[model samples]
Target: MQNFSKALLSWFDVHGRHDLPWQQDKTPYRVWVSEIMLQQTQVQTVIPYYERFMTSFPTLQALAEADQESVLAHWAGLGYYARGRNLHKAAQTILQQHQGEFPSDFEAIVALPGIGRSTAGAILSIALQQRYPILDGNVKRVLSRYFAVEGWPGEKTVEAQLWSQAQMLTPLARFDDYTQAIMDLGATLCTRSKPRCDACPVAHGCAALAQGRVAEFPFSKPKKTLPVRRASFLMMLNQQRQLWLTRRPSPGIWGGLWSLPQFESREDLIAALNPSMQTTEDSPASLVKWEEFRHTFSHYHLQIEPHRLDRVQEAPAEWQGQWHDLDKAAQLGLPAPVKKLVEQLEKEDGQNG
Candidate 1:
């Protein structure tokens, strides 16, 4: 275990990432934001988003004071809207309870929304220079292979074993560097596929590599068929060329983001556009059904059918939102699919013009 940490630190001194945006100031707030964004996201993918977010809300107090809509707008297309929401809530919590200071206590930090055990550990070790073991996805892969950990890492028992191994392997000195070093090793060398075992610093002691089962360790979760869902996004445009957009309700998919009005099917959309109680004077002049496309989530697939209603007089009484220019709507916090649709509409408008 001592040699494990020593070898990793030695390797890190030469090869570990040192110039990441979050690594510059190395504050708890910066690390917290980076850790949350890094969840289920690659470091390279997070860089630009993180830089933009920092520019918008540079401090915990700023994040707390900002509106959820603006916060989510910054997080648009990052996926996982809940993280952005929770981050805002947690910042407000800190402002109210912790006097706007990012909590340093381990228990207090984890209590904040979206700050789990692993994320808390990472912030403590990396930014605060505390001695704590982090077991993020990258570290889990590294430890699982190094110790030949079996069973899916998502399983509680398997995760516990990995946590124990992580605690034991964490060194007393330079734990911060060791933490970053191990994560770098997993990300760069012991990758999920075609792992660069030949260049791994700790490959000499990797149980999975020694036993010719490097790929077999860190077993994947049992497979299940992902169910598909269908949706119809209404692209209702007025004669003025402004599109009708609505904010999705919170505590659901794409929560806190502005999106095209969605319905279950074209029938539902048609019914809404031409409600039984409506007069012909309020009806849309033209209705066009665009092709359907698929937008996938982790748990399910959304088969999105887009419908465009042109030269609308007014939105249905049941729909609650505003109408905005297509280009301006695209600038709002929209789901990826909705954003694509907005861009497509913009392109078409350009062609027509």
Candidate 2:
């Protein structure tokens, strides 16, 4: 096991991503932030965002003290807004309860708002140099193929068996390098699609490689079809160059984020808009632009149609719509699709004027 660990680490020292910003200083805070950001996100995609986020919220106190809007603003382009919210909440917990320091104990780390066992293990092993086994997708693939574990890893019994194997193989000395090496090996060699067994450092010992089943050991369950949902967004603009936006409820998709008014259907939108449009008797409101866009979530797809109203008598529903300069709205924390809609509307308005 020590020789295997040494060989893996030797390979990692030369080939692994040693220059990543997060790897520069493997503090608990930095590792925690990077791990949380890396959830369901690729490392390449997270690099620039991670650097910018660390700059903005350099310390746990900074993150905990940050307003939800500011935190969401930094995390705007990053999907999974819930992670940002959880990060902020967890920071607050650490500040209030743990004196603004990340917990060193594995169990305490897992007890944080969004840190699970795998994430906790990652932090413990990488930052604290503790021997904790992680069962992330990459590790699962590498271990399952090396040991030829059977059944879909998502199943409880199968996952338990693989985890037991993982614990047995985790070395005590140089645990951090070994942990990262296996993850890197799985990500770069034992990939989900076409595993590069020839390039694997531990290929000689891989049972799946010998059996020509490298891609079959880490079995997956069948995927379900994502349901499609429909919604309507009203892009209301006033003469002051400000757009009307609303804060989403604190739960569900895009929760606690500011966005355009969304309705479940065209009828609901019409019913909601009619009374408000009727109250303002200066001029009749007409739809200046209509466009449809789609945003895909993990379990569903949202098909949204945007109805832009150029002129309106008064703002509806106590929205207190502010008149922001076009450039300022770009900096505000609007969702990516909403930002695109706003840009399109601004371009159209510029052309008309």
TM-score of each: 0.65, 0.64
Leading candidate by lDDT: 1
Record all residue pairs in model 2 with backbone atoms less than 3 Å apart, i.e. clashing.
Answer: none
Name the lDDT value of residue 274 in candidate 1: 54
lDDT for each candidate structure: 0.89, 0.81
Q: Roughly what TM-score does model 2 have, to 2 decimal places?
A: 0.64
Name the regions of candidate 1 deviating beyond 4 angstroms.
Answer: 224-353
lDDT of 2 at 230: 87
lDDT of 1 by residue, 1-353 (tens): 89999989999999999999998999999989999999999999999999999999999999999999999998998999879988998899899999998889899999887789999999999999988999989999999999999888988899999999999999998867888898899899999999999999998899999999998968988787466789998898877899999999998999999999888766556657755323246653667788999999999999999988777777877778999998788889999999999999999998998
Per-residue CA lDDT of model 2 for 285-331, tens digit only, reads: 76643767789888888998888776665676555444556646767
